[model samples]
Target: MDKPKRRNTETDPWSGLKMYTAARIALGRTGTSVPLKESFAFKMAHAHARDAVYSSLNLEVLLQGLHAFNLPVHVLHSMASDRMEYLQRPDLGRMLNQASSEQLKEEGSSSTEIAFVLADGLSATAVNEHAIPLLQLLVPALRQAGFTLAPLTVAEQARVAIADEIGELLHAKLSIIMIGERPGLSSPDSLGVYFTYAPKPGLTDEARNCISNIRPEGLPYSLAAEKILYLIQEAMRKKLTGVKLKDGIGLLQG
Candidate 1:
């Protein structure tokens, strides 16, 4: 019997296409099957995605990292007590536990211009790695923009909506939730920022603006910070965000 022909990946017409993006594309073949190396790579990517989802945020590391910014920080938890419950009950993840709410209330009712919430969303790996660095950039920028910041809030088992609850409890005019985005095969450690102006409980998704795919290999830190700062500036001037307010990419040109 003749052996099957293996397509030389180096000479495959489609191999060069991979240079354009991180997407899985242009895989070479062996006879009628995908190349063994490609199959192994796919499985590896899948493992990373799964691991990102189940990973727990290192609370001590996160807290210590936040302290480096010299800002007051508070820890909070969602009603969903565990990762299993967080995944199974998203609604619970979007609300603070009773203790967390009271803790925010005790901190005072002053209306801060912005509140930052670091949340362990779908990809804890993303949050654990990227949140502090992003916050380091964002906090200083917001201060320079004349926005008063609330004490930093670190939330566990949290969803984007949890930022609204924290903002409302802290009497903040805006809420920025830095969370781990849903991991994709090629991008397991992507973080996301969801900004909501005039955040309050029960506000719908249409009331927020999101900047996603924030990682070293995805959206670089400086660009992400610029975009976020742009949104915050626009949100303040327009007194709104979400569907009505556009990203104003053109504003970046000048």
Candidate 2:
């Protein structure tokens, strides 16, 4: 007996393109707006995106994941007391809380070659979901490269600039902060990585290098690690980062 043919429910000409990207594209329409199911899907996606932004990190869980690597982990807080303040006052999120500063000081003022920081940026969900897995691959690779690692620092209510203060406090030659990126309509769990060389408080955006959109569907962990490791080696060699330093991943691959 012959089997019946399967019919394609997505009739839009551009529907095939959906396979290429996560972007909301070629959504089938009814009159002016999308079909009821598609419209409802859009609403659900928006809710997920919003939830990712407002969510708080479970620091204990993150600590447990980091501890599995057998590395020293320290918890720190930004000056922002809560998520509300963190959203409203970005500058506060860029500085460590007084107690956190004291804690870092007590950990000792000895300089290290490099420090790794993890932070809950605009999307705590992203950090909770993706940061540790990337670190699982990155930390060992960094060690194999002969980099002396400092105690890993986990910062709550943090901004990318917070790494500068943490790096300065630890006297690290370089600091890499893995943080949650702002959620998009489709990418609620995308993570970001930022690096600063000889980080300090007054440094501008031009002083750091960023690799963004890291997730399973975005930049895969292994490739992101390779790019980051390449950048760090170059940053150390040139004693620079940010605009002046080029991401040599392509060149290295070539």
Candidate 3:
């Protein structure tokens, strides 16, 4: 018998470009509906995104990793009380609990160049996976620049702004927070960094500069560190962040 002809569905024109990214693209369709494989893959991605949102920070692992940095580490909480409250009452997550506030005031250093904060935000899995690695690369650069660093603060059930209070209490000139970014179907475990000069309570988003999508598959640790270091140096030199401090990497580099 002659070899049988195999059946093939219509292939997307962009199928060749699919290899360049993890984005959903070029899924070959079967008849009037999406192929079962693509549908299932989408469902799986959605599940991963959802799981990232609900995940808890593994503090023990985080603390152990932080200790190697040799800075006094303080674990704090937002007024949200729990994950549910943190999600529902965003205002509460912007401030620290009473005891946590007092502790920072008492133990935190005075007038440091920068304060590093790690917060478990929308996706704790992101922080658990990427925060330390980024910090490990950036911290040494800060130290070499003769900048004084405040104690490392780790906050659970927290949001980005809570670092403002931490930096203010510590009397830090600048605050850089590494937080878990909200999950997306294609990027469930993305870490984000927010750098603010002259941080204080009640400051809005415009007062800070954000470096987002930090991950091995996205922005790798070394490049992220380089950008952060540049931002910090520029922010310190210019006494500002936010929209004013543009990222001038190679252009400004001598």
- Model 1: CA > 4 A from native: 1-10
Tens-digit per-residue lDDT, 92-130, candidate 1: 999999999989889986778888899889998999889
lDDT per model, in order?
A: 0.90, 0.90, 0.91
Q: What is the alpha-carbon lDDT for the whole of candidate 2?
A: 0.90
Candidate 2's C-alpha runs over 4 A off are: 1-11
Backbone clash count, each prediction separately = 0, 0, 0
The positional error of residue 11 in candidate 3, measured at the CA in angstroms, is: 3.7
- By summed lDDT, which 10 consecutive residues of candidate 1 come out lowest? 7-16
Q: Is candidate 1 or candidate 3 better by lDDT?
A: 3
Candidate 3 residue spans exceeding 4 A from truth: 1-9
| TM-score list, all predictions | 0.93, 0.93, 0.94
State the lDDT at 117 in candidate 1: 92
